[model samples]
Target chain A: MKIGIHGLTSCYGCQLSMAVVKRILDVSEKFDIKYFYMLSSAGKIEHVDVAFVEGSVSTDEDEKELRMIRENADVLVAIGSCAIHGGVQSILFSEGIGYEEAFKTVYGDKKMDYNGRIAQPLDKFVKVDYRLPGCPPEEEEIMYYLATFAIGSWPEEKDYPVCAECRRAGNPCILIEKGEPCLGPVTVAGCDARCIKYGIPCIGCRGPVSDVSWFDSLAMSFRDRGMDKEYVKKRMAIFASRYEGLNEMIDKIYGD
Target chain B: MRYLKLGSRNIDEFLGRISNYGDLYAPQKISEKFYDYRKVEDISQVEFNYNRTITPAKKYFIPPKHEMFEFDMETGEYTETMGDVKPFVLFGLHACSIVALRILDGVYLNEYPDKYYAARRKAGIIIGISCLPDEYCFCNLRRTDFVDIGFDLFLHELPDGYLIRVGSERGHEIVDENMDIFEEVSNDDIENFKKFEKKRHEMFKYEGSFDNLRYILELTENSPLWDEESEKCLGCGNCTMTCPTCRCYDVQDLPDIDGKHGKRIRFWDSCQFRSHGLVAGGHNFRETKKDRFINRYVCKNAYFYPLGTSYCVGCGNCTYFCPAGIDFLKNLIKIRDVVGEVAHGEQ
Candidate 1:
C-alpha cells in the first residue's frame, strides 16, 4: 500500500509515466503515495511496501539514498530502461571515458568542485525486486503490475522475445521485407511491440528476453539476411552492454 | 463442412452477404506487384492470392499512431479512450502473417491483458487464404504452418468453387445464417483439401536446418568477420521499421509551442539510431555501430530464446529491403563457416 518513488540522474520519464497513469484513473484510493521526490516534498523516510526507483546511480548522493531505500523497502522495482540496465550512461565504460572528461565537455574548463565515475544501474548498488524495462514504462503495463502487486498476486514475468508479440500483432516481417536490422528476435516483449507495429525494429531497450543463448538461430537468421557481423554485434550491445557474456561475444567478433 | 459453389457471377452476392455484418477489409492492388489491405465495397476488388502486403495485419489491431489516452494539460486531467470495437471480417490473411498475429496475442492477451489492443482485436474476424509462397518466406523453417491457428474461417480454392472451413463459433454463425448459399462438403472434397495442404508443404521448403542456431551463436561470438561485414551499414533503420518482430520504442511528451500543452506519445524507435541508448547526461552505452549491430544479434538469437519466444521469424524481409544489400542469410552462413574454421585451426 505505501509506495515511494525516486529518481537519480534520469530523464524522469518513468516517474512522469506513473504520474500519467494517476491522472488517467483514480488509483489514489488503491495506493498510498508516501514519498516521491518529484510529486511531493522530500520528507523523513519511513518503511514502505514498495519503492519505485528510476535512473542510474551516477552520484555518491544517489548511492547513499539508494542503499537506505533498499534497506527499508520490502520491494524495490527498477522502473525504466535507465534503472533496469546502466542505460546509455554505461556507454562511458565502453570508451574508458571518465566523468571528469564528460563534465569538461559540458562546462568547457569551468572548475568543478567534485566529479565521480560513470553511472550504473541501481542493481549494481543493491538488489532489485522487479524491473519494468523501457525508455519510459508503458502505461498499461505499469497499471497491470500495480494492480497485481496490490492484490498480493505478483504478475508472471514475461520472458518471451519481442518477435512473438510482433508476429501476433500481424505486422509484416520487417527484417525480411524491409531489410531492416531489428532487435525484436532478441529483445524482451512487454510494450506489445508498439515500435515494430509502427514500422520500426526493436532496439533491445527492454533488455534481453530470458535465456539469450537459446535464440541464437534468430540472431543468425539476421546474418542469413546478409547483415554484417559488426552490425549485429553493435546492435546486440545496446541493452546488454553491461552483460559480461554478451560483451565477451562482441569482443570475440570485433577483436577487443 | 459447408462448400460454396460460387460461379464467377455469384462473387458480388458473396461480398454483399459478408458486408451485412460490418466493414470488410481485404487486399487491394496499390501498384504493380504491391498490395495493401483496405475496406472493399466489391468482392472482385479483393486480391486473394497476392504474395504479401507492405504492412501486416497489425494495423487493424494496433494502428500506426494510436492515442492511448488524451490529456488536458491545463486541467491536469486525463481521459482514457477505449479503442473502437466492431465485428468485422479480415479477408485473405496469409499463413506467415497470421502466425505473427498469434505470437502477439500470446504476449498482449495472455500474460498482461492489453485492454486497448484486446478491444480492437475482438472487433475483427480472421478469414485466411493459402497463397503462393514468396522467395523471401521461411515460415515453414520456423515450423509455422498454414491454417494452424484456428481462424474464424479458412478458404481453399478449387476448380469449380471454394471450400470453407468454419473454425470458430462466429464463423459457423455466418454459415448458419446463410445456409441458402452453401452446399454440404462431400468426402471427396475433404480429400482434395488434404491434397492442397500437401502441395503447399512441397512448395515451401526449409532452406536450412535450425538445429545449429545455438552453436552458431557461440562460434560467432569471436568471429573476426563481423568487423568487415558491418562497414557498409548506413544505420538508416529501415529494416527494423518493416520487420514483423522488432518492437523497441521511444516515449516522449510532445508539448505544443507554448510548452504548456502536450500529449505523451510512444513512437517506434530503432537501436540502429545513434542516440537510441544515450542517456540524459550524454552517455551512450552502445556507442559504436559495431557494438550496436552485434547487440541486435545477441538479443534476438541469444537473449530472446531464454525469454520463451524467438524474435526473428526468418521472413527474409531484411535482406530484400536493405539499401546497402546486407544479406542476412549469407552473413549467417559466413559466420558459421568462419567460426567453424577458426575452431578447427583452419582459418
Candidate 2:
C-alpha cells in the first residue's frame, strides 16, 4: 500500500506526530510513504491506496490541491483536528472578516492581490472516508486506522465521551477533585484525559462527540459550577463558530 | 475484592515493596497548592490528597517535549528515535484524571494506533486513589467516578487501613506478590465500602448534562454574545495550557548553533491566540478575537461531535483557570436564553 500526506494551513503537528510513529515503529515496512511535503520533495500524484490530508482549506491553492488529491486517491483521510473540524482555522468563518481583509491584515504593505473566501475543512470540498481528529493526530491512532484500513477492515468509530475514558483510566475526576471546568463530558473520547491526568482540565482539543447536545450539556455543566453564562458562550464559540446549531444555543442561553 | 492494612506511616514500606517490580513515580509537593509526579525514593513525600496537579498524568504516556526524530541539515538525513523507558508505576492518580487517560487511549490505541504513545504506555502501571471533592470539582456533573481502566490496582482509603481492588491480571499479580500485606474482604468490609461510596457521592453532584449544549451552541451563532464575550478575553492562553484535553500543538524545527543539526519540538498552542490560524504568505484565518473565541467552544461542543466524541469533558478547569474569569457555565445559559429570545423575535 502507498500513502501520501499533505498539509494545508495548519501547525504541522499532525505531520510531526506521523513522523514520531516512524521513529517508534517501522511503519515504512507496511506502507510506502510516497509523498510528504516536509519530508520529501513534492512528488507527482499517483494512484495511492490512502492519502492523509492535514490542516484546513484556507486558500485557493489548498482547495485546488485537495481536489486533485481527492481525484487520485482511493481513500482520503482527514488527519489532525484542523483537517477534520477546521482545527483553529475555521475561526475566520464565524467572524465577518472576509478572507481578503484577513490576508491584507497579515501581509501588510505586500503587493499580493488575492480574493477572500471562507476557510473550511476538507470535507466541505471533497469526500473524506475517515477523519483522525486531534490538534495533532495521536501517533498511535493514526497507525491503528491505517493498519485497519490496510487489512481491508474499517475501524469502528468511537462514541464515548472523554469522561467515560477518564473514569475507566482510574484517574481522579478533575471536576470533582479540583472544581475545575472541563470539556471531558461532551468532548469525544481519544486524548486519554492527558490534561486531566496531568492535573490540568480538558480543553476539548479532540472536538465534540457524535451528539451535538453534548456541547449544551458541557456548557450547562459549567453554569452549574457557577461559571458566568456569557463566558461559556464566548469560550465555546472560539473553536466551533461554524457549528450553527451550537452557536444559536450559546446565544439563547447567554442572552446575546 | 481484597483488603490491606498498611498504616499511613508505613507507606514507605509499601513503596519499598513495589520498588522490586520497577520504578516508582508518585505525587510530590512542589509548592503550596501545587504537586508534580516525580521519581520518589521515599513514600513519605507522596501527597495523596492534592486537589489536582498543575499538569495531567498524560505526560507519562505522551511527554510534552518528545523527540520524534532528529535531522542533520548537513546531510539532509533524519534519524528516528523510540523512547524505551523501563516500566514504572504511577501512584496517586485521581478518578477523573484516570478517565482522561482512558479517553486518550481510545484515541491513540483505536484508529491510528500511536506507536510512540503505545510504547510509552506499555512501560507504566497505574495505581489510583479516591480524591476529596473541593469547591471547583464537577466530575459528578460529567458522570465521572472512580474507574479501573488500564490500572493494575486501585486504592480506596479507609479510617483503619486501605482497601485494594484488583482491576487487572497485573493487579492480581501485584496482590499475590504482596499477599502477606493483604487480606480477603469480609461482609462487614463490603458494607463499609458502600458507606464510603455513599458519603463521597453526597459530597459530589452532577453539575449539569451536555444534552442541551449542542442546541445552545447552534443558536449562539451570529448572536450578539460573541461580541460581548470577546470584549473580556485577553487571549493569554491560560485556559488551553491548563486544559487536560486541549491537545492542539505547534511543531517547530529548532536549529543547533551551526544550523546543521536541529530537532523538531512540539509545543502546546491555543485557539484563543490570534496568530494560531495564520499561514505562509501571511494569511490569517481567525483575525478577530470574537471569531477565535467562538471557535474554541464550537470545536469542543459542535464540530468535534459529528466527527466522533465530544472533546469537552465539563471538568470546569476552564472556568477555574481562565485569567479573564470567563465562566463557561454562565455562557451556556446566556447563549440558550438569548438564542431563544431571538428565535421568538423578542430581541
Candidate 3:
C-alpha cells in the first residue's frame, strides 16, 4: 500500500521516530514509501492508502498541506504528541498567546520566513482516524499499529495510567514509596513506564488518559507530599494543559 | 503438621539450600516502604517486615505478560511449548498472599485450565512468613491474616530464631534434607508464637464486621456515591490490577513485520479501559466514568463474592499503591454506613 509520512510545524522527531520504526520493523518491505518529505524528493501524490501526519498546523501553508493530504488519503493518522495534543510548541497556545507577541517575546525583531500562526492538533482542522500519543510516538506503538493495520485491523490503545505498566514492570511506586511527585497515575501508559523504570518520575508527556478524574487528586496528593500547589499545576500544564479535564482540575484547585 | 525451630543465624544457609533446587525468590526492599519479589543471590537481602509489594505472588504464576505459544505464517505452523519450569522456592510470602495464591488456583486450575499458570504453580514451593500489620493493612478484616493448608512451610519470626511449621510433604522433605539447620520446637517457642499472634492482632486498626457489606453492595445500585467518586476517578486500574483477587486478562497475536512469524501473548487487562467494555456498533456499555468506577466495586463484592470465594484480600495494596490513594474500603464503608432507607437500582 502507498504510505505518506507528512510533517508540519515540528522538530521532525516523529519522522525520526518513524525512521527508527522503519529500520526495526523493516516497513519498507511491505509499504511503498511514496511521499515522506524527509525521505523522498518526489513530493506530489495523487492518492495514497494511508497518510501519517506529524506535528501541528502552525501556518497557513501547514493548514493547506494537512487539508490536501486529508483529501488525498484514505487514512490520516496523527503520529505524535504535536499532531495529537499540540506538543511543547503548544505551550503558548495553552496560555492563549498569539504569534506576534510570542515571536517578539522569544525572538525579538527577527522577522523573516513564513506565515506563522498559533499551533493546533490535526483533528482541530480535519478528522484524524487514529492518534499515537507520545513526545515522539512510542516506537512499539507505531509498530503495533502498522502490524495490525497491515492485517486490516487496528490495535487497541493502552488507555490506563502509566502506573499500571509500572506495576507490570515491577517498579516500586516512586511517588508513594520515596515521596517523589510522579505523574504515573495521571498519565497514559504505552511508554512502558519509561521514566519510572530509570528511577526518574513520570512527567506525563503523553497526557492524561481519558475518563481520568483523579488529576486533581494526584495533584493534591503531590501537594500532600510537600510540593507547592502551584508547582503541581505548573508540572501538569507542562504536558497536558490543553486537555479540558486537566484544565478544569487546574481551575478547580487554583481558581484560575 | 510438624513444628520445627530455625535459628536466625542459619537463615541464609537454609535459604541458600532452597536456592540449589533452581531459583529462589524473596521480597527485596526496592524503596523505603515498598518490597518486590526478586530472584535472590544472597538470602540476607530477603525481608518480611514489608506491608505490601507492588504485586502479590499471583504475578509469578499468571505473570503480567505471558507468551502462550509461537506461530509461523509461512506454513501455517504453530508450536505450543511448556516454558522453563524448574522447581523454585518462593520464600517470605505474607499470610494474606498464601490465600491469594489459592484464590488464583481456583480460577486458573478450574474447567478451562491455563496450562502455563498450572506449570508455574507445580514448580513453585510456597514458604509463608509472619507479617506484622500496619495502619494500611485490613487483611484481618477479610480473615486473610493466617492460613492453614495452602503453604508447604511457614516461618514465624522470633528474636533469635524462627518457629517453623511443616504443612505438606514438600515441607517435610526440606526439613529432612536440611536437618542440620532445624531443631525441635520447645515449650518456650510455643509461648513466643502465642505472644507474637497477640501483638499481630493489635497492629490492625479497622475492626468491624464485614458480614453486612455484601448486602450494602447488593442493594446500592443507584447511589450518588458512584457519581461523587467519579469526579476524582481516573479509572486508572491501579485498584483492580493491584487487587489480588482481580484476574481479568486479554490475549492477542503478536505477529512480525512480514506477518510470517509471531507469538500469541496474554497480558493483564482491566475493565477500566475504554475498550474493555466496548461491543458491536462501537457501543461501550461502561461509557461513563461512573460506570467503570462503580463496576470495580460491584465486581469485587456483588460479582466475585457470591461465587463462594474471598474476592477482596484486604492487603491494602490498592490503598497505598494508588497515585490518588483512593481506597475501595473507604467507599465500601461509606456505602455500608448510610442511615437512610434502601435505594435499590438507582445507578
Candidate 4:
C-alpha cells in the first residue's frame, strides 16, 4: 500500500511525532511510503492507497492541493487539530476578526498577497474518511487508529467527555475538588485526559463532543464555580469557536 | 456480631496476611484529595479515614468495561471471557458503600444472576470503616451510617487501636487467624463504640424526612420541580456513573473483519446520556432531560423499593462526582415539599 503524507498549513509536528515515535515500534513494514516532503526527495504522487493530510485549508494553493490529494487517494485522513477542527489560527477567523487586517497589523503595509476567505478543515473542501483530533494527535492514539485501519476496520473514536477517562484514571474531578473551571465535560476524550491528570483544566483542544448542548450551560457552570465570565467564554471558544451554531449559542447566552 | 481490638502497630501485619489470600484493596489517595480503590500492597497507603473514594468498590465486581464472551465464527468456536476469582478483603469501605453493594445485589443477582458479578461478589470480604461526614453526606437520611447487615467486619478507629465488629463467620475466621494481634474489647471500648455511633448520627444533618417518600414521589410526578432541576442536569451521566445503586449498562460487540473472532463487552451506561432510552426506531421514551432526571428519583423512591430493602443509601457519590453540582438530597427535599402540598389538598 502506497501512503502519502501531505501538509497544507501546519507545524509538521504531527509528522515529526510519527518519525520520532513510530521508529522505535518499527511498523514501517505495514505500507510503502510514496510521497513525503520531509522524509523523501519529493517523490511525485500520482495515486496512493492512504493519504494522511495534516493542517487546514487556509490558502488558494492549499485548497487546490487538497482537492488533488482527495481525488488521488482511496482513503483520506485528517490527522491533527488543524486538519480536523481548524487549528489555533482558525480561532481568529471564527471570531470574525479578518485575517487580512491582522496580517497588516503585524506586517505593517508590506504589500503582501495571500488569498483565502476563511481557514477551514479539509472536510469543508472535501470528504475526510477519518479524523484524529488533538493539537497534535497523541502518538498512542495515532498508533491505535493506524493499527485498526490497517486491519480494514474503522477504529472507534472516543467522542465522550474527557471526564470519563479522568474518572477511570482515578483522578478526582479538578473542577469539583479545586474549584477549577474544567472543560473536561465539553471536550472529547482519547487524549487520556493528560491535562486533568497533570492538574491543569482541559482547554478543549481536541474539539467538542456530543451530549454537550452547545456549551452554554457549561459556561454557566464555570461562573457558578467563581470563574470570570469572560474567561469562561474565551476558554469555551478556544477550539470549538468555529463549530457551527456555537456562535449563536454564545449570542443567546451573552445577549450580543 | 463479635468484637475484636487490633493494636494500631499490627494493622499492617493483619492486612498483609489477608493479601496472601487474594487482592487486598482499599481507598488510596492517588492524587491530592482524589481517592479510589487501589491495590494496597503498602499498608501505609490505605486511607481508612477518607470520607469516600471517587469510585466505589463496585468497579471490581462490575468494572467500567467488562468482556462477557468471545467467539470465533470461521472455526465456530466460542469462548466465555471469565477472569479467575480469589478471596478479596476490601479494607476501607464506608458504611454508605457497604449498603450500596447490598442494593446492587438486587439488580445483578436477581431472578437472573450475573455469573461474572456473582463470582466477584462472593469473593469479596467487606471490611467497613468509620467515615466522618462531609458537607455533602446525607447517608443519615437513608440511614446508611449504621448498617444492620452487609459487611464481614466493621472497624471504628480509636487513638490507640481499632474497635472491630466481626459481623460474620468469615470475619471471625480472619480475626481468629490473627488472635496474637487482636485482643478482647474492654468495657471502655464498648462505651467508645456507643459514643462513635451517637456522634455519627449527630454529624449528619439529614434535611429530608422519608416518612411518605413514595407518596411524595407520586405527588411530584407532574410538579414543575423536575423541569427546574433537570435544567441543571448536564446529561454527562457523572451522577449515574459514580452512583453505587445505579447499575444500568450498555452491551457492546467488538468484531473482527473476518466475521469470525469477536468479543462481547458490557460497559457501564448512564441514564443521563441521550442514548439510554433510545429505541430501535430512534424513538426515546424520556425525550426531555426533566423526565430522565426525575426518573432517577422515582426509581430510588418508588420503583425499586420492593426489589431491595432500600433503593438509595445516599452515599453522595452522585453529588461529589457530578460536574453540574446537582445535589440529590437537596432536590428530594424540594420535591417532598411539593408532595406535602398535594397530599394536604387531597386530604
Candidate 5:
C-alpha cells in the first residue's frame, strides 16, 4: 500500500512521533511512501492508499494543501489533536476571539504572505475517515493504525474516559484528593493514564470522547472543587475547542 | 476448626516459613494514604493495619490486563500465553475481601469453568485477618464482616497477639510445623475475643438493613435519583475497576508491525463506559449517563443479590475514589425512602 504523511500547521510533533516509532523499519517494508517530507526529501503530493494528515487548517494555503491531499488519497486520517480538535490554537475560539482580533493583537499593521484564518479541524474542510487523538499521538496507537491499514482493517477509537485506565493502574485520584481540575473523567483514554501515574493530572490532550464525555458535568465538578467557570472552560478548550457541542455543553452548567 | 494463639513477635518467623509453600503477598503502603497488594520480600513490608488496598487480591488471579494468547495475523494460528502459574500465599486479607473471592469463585469456578481463574484459585492460599471497620466499611450490613470459612487460616487481632483459627489442612500443617510458637487458647483469651468482637461491632458508623434492600432496589427501578446523580457522574469508570467482583472485560487483537505476529489481549472493561454497551452500526444500549450509572447499582444490588447475599462486598472503593463523590449507601437510602413513601400512600 502507498501512504503519505503530511503536516500543514502543527509543531510537527505528531509526525515526529510517527517517524521515531520503534517499528518504523517493519512498517516501511509493508507500505510505499509516496510523500513524506519529514522522512524523505520527496515532497510531491501524489495518489496514495492512505494519507495521515497532521495539524489543523489554519491558513488558506493549508486548506488548499489539505484539499489536494484529500483528493489524492483514498483514505484521510486526521492525526493528532491539532488536526482532530484544532489543538491549543483554537482555545480562544469559544471565547469569541477570531483570527483578525488575534492577529491584530499580535502583529498590528503587518500584512504579508498567505491569508490567515481561524484554526479548524481537518474534517471542517474535508471528510476524515479516522482520527488519531493526542497532543502528539502515542507511538503504540500510531503503530496500531499502520498495522491495521497494512492488513486492510481500521483502528477503533476508545469511547471511555482516562479514569478507566487510571484507576486500574491504582493511581490516587488527584482531582478529588488534591482538588486539581484533572480532565481524566471526560477525556478520551488510550495513553494508559501516563500523566496520572506520574503524580500529574491529565490535561485532556487527547480531546473529548465521542458524544460521551460529559463536559457540563466535569465543569460543574470543577466548580464544586472551587474552580471558576472560566478556569474550567479554558482548561478544557485547550485540546477540545472544535469538539462538537462542547461549548454548548459547558454553557449548560456555567450559563451563556 | 482448631484455634491457636501466636504472639506478635513470631509473625515474621511464621511468614518466613510460609514462603516455602508459595510467594507471600500482603498489603504494603504505597504512599501516605494509599495501600496496594505487593509481593512480600520481607515481613516488614506488610501493613496489616491498612484500610484497603487500591486493587483487590483478585488481581493476582485475573490481572488487570494480560495477553491471553498470541496468534498469526494472516493464518490465525495461535498459542496460549498463560505464563507459568504459581501458588502464592496471600496474607492479611480482610474478612470482606475473603468473601469477595467466594463470590468470584461462583462466577469463575462453576459450570464451564475458566481455566486460568480455576488454576490460580486452586493455587492460592488465603490467610484472612480481622479488621476494625472504618466509616467507609459496610461489610457488616452485607454480613461479610466476619468470615467463618473460605480461608486457609484466619488471624483475629488481640491485645498482644493473634487468635488464629485453622480452616484448612494447610493451616493445620503450618500450625503443627511451628508448634513451638503456637499456644493453646485459655478461658481468658476466649473472654477477650468476645469482648473484642463486641467492640468491633459497636465501632461501625454506617447502618442500614439489607433485609429488604434487594426488593426496594427492584421496586425503585425508575427512581429520579438515578438521573439526578448521573448529572454528577463523570462516567470515569473508577468505581467498577476498583470493585472486587466486577469481572467485565474487553478483548482486542493487537497485530505487530511485522504483520505476521499478533496477540489477543483481555483487559478490565467497565459497564460505566459508553463503549461497553455500544453495538455495531453506531447504536448504544445505554446511551445516557443515567442508564450507565444505574446499571452498576442494578448489577450490584438487585440482579446479583441472591440467596440472601449481595454481590457488593461493601469495600466502599466506589464511594472513596469517586471524583464526583457519589455515595452508594446514600443513594440506596434515598431510594428506599422514596419507595417507602409510595408503599405507604398505596396502603
Candidate 6:
C-alpha cells in the first residue's frame, strides 16, 4: 500500500514520533512511501493508498494542502491532537477571542507571509476517514494503524476514556483524591494514562472521545470541586477547542 | 476444618520456603495509601494490614490484557497463547476478595469454562488473612465479611500470633511442609481468635443493610436517582474495571505488518463505556448514561439475586477508586429509600 505522512501547521512532534518508531523501517519496507516530508525532501502532491495528515488547518495554505492530500489519498487519517481537535492553538477559538486579535498580539503587525485563520481540525476542512488522537500519537497506535492498513483491515478506535486504563493501571484517582482537575475521565484512552502514571493529572492532550465525553457533567463536577468555571473551560480548550459540542456542553452547565 | 497456629515472627521464613513451590504474590504498598498484589521478591515487601488493593484478585485469573490466540491469515491456522501459567500462591487476600474470587469462579468456571481463566485459577493458591474494615468497606452488609470455604488457609490475627484455619487438603499439606513454623492451637488461642473476630466486626466504620436490594431496585426502576447519579458519573469505567465480578471484555485481532500473522487479544471492557452497548449498525441500546448506570445496579443486585447471589462482594474498590466518588452502597440505599417513600405515600 502507498503511504503518505503529511504535515500542515503542526509542531512536527507527531511526525517525529512516527519517524522514530522502532518498526518505522519495517513499516516503510512493507508499504510504498509515496510522500513523507519528515523522512525525505521529495515533496510532491501525489496520490497514495493511505495518507496520515497531521496538524490543524491554521492557515489557507494548510487547508489547501490538506484538501489536496484528501483528494489524492484513498484513505486519509487525521493524526495527533492538532489534526483531530485543532491542538492548543485552537484555544483562541474557545476563549471567545478573534484570530486576528490573537495574531496581532503575537506577531505585532509583522509582514504577511500566509493567510492566517482560527485553527480548526482536519474534518472541518476535509473528510477524515479515521483519526489517531494524541498530542503526538502513541507508538503502539501508530504501529496498529500501519499494520491494520497493511493487512487490509482497520484499527478499532477506543470509545472509552483514559480512566479505563488508569483504573486498570491501579493508579490512585488524582481527581477525587487530590482534587486535581484531571481530564482522564473525559479524554480518550490509548496513552495508557501516561500522565497519571507519573503522578500528574491528565490535561486531555488526546482530545475528547468522539461523542461520549460528557463535558457538561464533568464541568459541573469540576465546579463542585471548587474549580473556577472559566478555568475549567480554558483547560478543556487547550487541545479540544474544536471538540464536537464542547463549548455548548460546557455552557449548558456554567451558562447563565 | 483443621486449625493450627503460626507465629508471626516465622512468616518471612514460611514465605521464603513457599517461594520454591511457585511465585509468591502478596499485597505490597504502592504508595502512601494504595496497595496492590505484586510479585514478592523479598519477604519484607508484603503488607499484612492493607485495606484493599486497587484492583481485585480477579486480575490474576483474567489479566487486563490477555492475548487469547495468534493466527496466521494465509494458512488460517491459530494457536492459543495461554502462556506458561506456573503455580503461584496469592497470599494475604481479605475475606471480601476471597468471596469476589468465588463469584468470578461461578462466571468463568461454570457452563462453558474459559480455558485461560481455568488454567490460571488452577495454578493459584489462596491464602486469606483477616482485615479491618476501613470507611469505604461494606463487606459486612453484603455478607462477605468472613470467608470459610473459599480460601485454602485463613489466618485470623491474635495478640500473640495468627490462628490458621485449614480449609482444603492443600492447606493441610502446606501446614505439614512448614510444620516447624506452626504450633498446636490451644483453647486460649481459639478464645483469642473469637474475641479478635468480634472486635473486627465492631471496627467497621461503614455499615448498611443490603437485604432485599434486588426487589428495591426492581420497584425503583424509573427512580430519578438514576439520573442524579448518572450526572455525577464520569463514565470512566473505573468502577467496572476495579469491580472483581465484572467479566465484560472486548476482543481484537492485532495483525503484524506482514498481513499473514496476527494475535487475537481480549482486554477488560466496561459496561459503562458507551461503545459497550453499540451494535454493528451503531445502535446503542444504552444510549443515555442513566441507562448504563441503572443497568450496573440491576446486574449487581437484581439480575443474579434470584440465584441467591448479588454478584457484589462489597469490597469497596468501586467507591474507593471512583474519581466521581459514586458509592455503590449509598446508591442502593438511596434507591431503596425512594421506593419506600413511594410505597408509604400510596399506603
- lDDT scores in order: 0.67, 0.68, 0.79, 0.76, 0.85, 0.86
Model 5 clash pairs are none
Candidate 4 per-residue lDDT, tens place, B271-333, comes to 765667778887988777777887788777653553344577777788877788778877877
Q: TM-scores for all candidates? A: 0.56, 0.54, 0.94, 0.85, 0.95, 0.95
Poorest stretch of ten by lDDT in candidate 5 chain B: B301-310
**What are the per-residue Cα lDDT tens digits for candidate 2 across A137-235?**
676577667656655555444444566455434455566455577766556666767887787877777866543323554554566578787667656
> What tens digits encode model 3's per-residue C-alpha lDDT throughout B82-186?
567889889888888888888777778874688898999999999999989887788887777888878989999887789998989988888898999898888
Root-mean-square deviation per candidate = 12.5, 14.9, 2.9, 3.9, 2.1, 2.2
| Tens digit of per-residue lDDT, candidate 5, span A1-256 | 9999999999999999988988778878998988888888857999999999999889999999999999999999999888988888878787789888999999998986989888899988899999988879898899888988887888887888899888777777788778888999988998999998888889999988867888888888787788887788888888888777888988888788
Judge candidate 3 against the unseen true structure and give its global Cα lDDT, from 0 to 1: 0.79
Please tell me which predicted candidate would have the highest lDDT against the true structure.
6
On lDDT, the stronger of 2 and 4 is: 4
TM-score of chain B of each: 0.83, 0.85, 0.93, 0.93, 0.94, 0.95
Q: Supply candidate 4's per-residue lDDT for A181.
A: 75
**Mind giving the per-residue lDDT tens digits that candidate 6 earns over B243-268?**
87898999998898777899998989
The TM-score that candidate 1 achieves is: 0.56
Scanning candidate 4 chain A in windows of ten residues, the lowest lDDT window is A18-27
DockQ of 2: 0.02
Ranking by lDDT: 6, 5, 3, 4, 2, 1
Q: Candidate 6 DockQ score? A: 0.69
* Candidates, DockQ: 0.03, 0.02, 0.59, 0.27, 0.71, 0.69
Docking class of 6: medium
What's the lDDT for candidate 6?
0.86
